[model samples]
Target: MSGISSASGILAARSALLAAAKAALDGQTDIDFYSGWQYPVTQPNWVATTDVHADMDPANIGPRRSQDETITLGVSIGAWLPGHTEDDIVAAFERAFSILNTIQTHIRTEDITLADTVLWCVPGATDSDGAVDEDGSGYQVEIATTFVCQHRVRAA
Candidate 1:
């Protein structure tokens, strides 16, 4: 039996999200991980990241060693308008929330498969709801999904 490492699981999760988002959203949005671009200004974009602590389980030491892992995938969506008015901010928030919902729905219904490893992914809770920025740049919304991947350590 082969075991899937944490690094591989993270990569696969990211790839699956990017593909799903692009396919569902007509390929008009940008997706990346650990990007340096500023939020709000970079409208119609998503940033993907893995929660280091929330997704890992301690290794089991025994014959047929296996570990239960939960991979938390975060997707942050941002949108902006070039006005300072209250209406403009509200519009921005609505736009960002719309995109966020679209992404979330796609992940929940679509079938995500990792080509390199045998892993299972399911939609999890969403956090960091939409909020208009005080700086008046725009609004930002974030949604997260947990993917449970079962890994078995290969015998040495």
Candidate 2:
């Protein structure tokens, strides 16, 4: 049981995921990994992990001895370029998608179970959307996906 509640298990899963991401992105100086929120993003290329939602229900109808849970965690990829030209936008797009691909491949092969903290983990389809600043600050591209982690929580 490992004294793992649904909430605690979710936390453990996120931590493990962050660690795995760090390991996967290490030595790639161009990519920066953040565990949570980042304000006024400074890097041209960066990835962030955030909490999305969670679902939990009793594993059995009787006595609430255990529960099955799913926790959704988000990964956000951002690419920015100072120039606002069409070529700059294309470059940003390529960089953002390349980062997304690296992340997807790492998630697929590296830590599907989040270091045994969960039964299994899988990233959902990515949602891509972004905006360009009217003031010409930079060209920005963002891609986001969620990793759903399933686990069983036992009574403490």
Candidate 3:
């Protein structure tokens, strides 16, 4: 039997998923989507795609060394409003929701498989934290969603 390790499969799946998400988000034209560890909060508004976690199932289903892997990708939206008011904060939340909606739509309509790298994908729960001061300066609004992608890793 010969095949790639589960680790390799997970890494490939993660990268492909991130690239697909970034491409979809970048088409928005109003928001910037970035990958990797460098998260720039200095920007007034932006979107971030990060690989949160990866896991592999213990059981092998195929004839060779095979396991199912799940990659959790996080997409976060941030807006930094300096010297903002209540109305401003509310507006930020509205905008954030709109962006989230677009992301959801893209996932549902677009080819999430990334050319078979991912077998399947589903949007996970969403969380929001905002309307609070950022470092004692201005208000900040943040929203995040997770995508759980599954793929099969096999070597034969």
Which regions of candidate 2 fall more than 4 Å away from where they truly are? 1-7, 59-64
lDDT of 2 by residue, 28-129 (tens): 786677889787666677888876677876544236567777788888888888787888888888888887776667867987777788877787768886
lDDT of the candidates, in the order given = 0.52, 0.76, 0.68
Candidate 3 on 83-103: residue-level lDDT in tens? 577787787787787777766
- TM-score head-to-head 2 vs 3, winner: 2
What is the alpha-carbon lDDT of model 1 when measured against the actual structure? 0.52
Give every collision pair in model 3.
3-155
TM-score of each: 0.60, 0.82, 0.76
Candidate RMSDs in Å, in order, are: 4.5, 2.8, 3.8
Rank candidates by TM-score, best first.
2, 3, 1
Query: What's model 3's overall lDDT?
Result: 0.68
Top TM-score model: 2
Q: Any runs in candidate 1 off by more than 4 Å, and if so which?
A: 1-8, 27-54, 58-62, 112-119, 122-156
- Model 3 sits at a Cα RMSD from the real structure of 3.8
**How close to the true structure is residue 47 of candidate 2, measured as C-alpha lDDT?**
84
* 28: Cα error in model 3, Å: 4.0
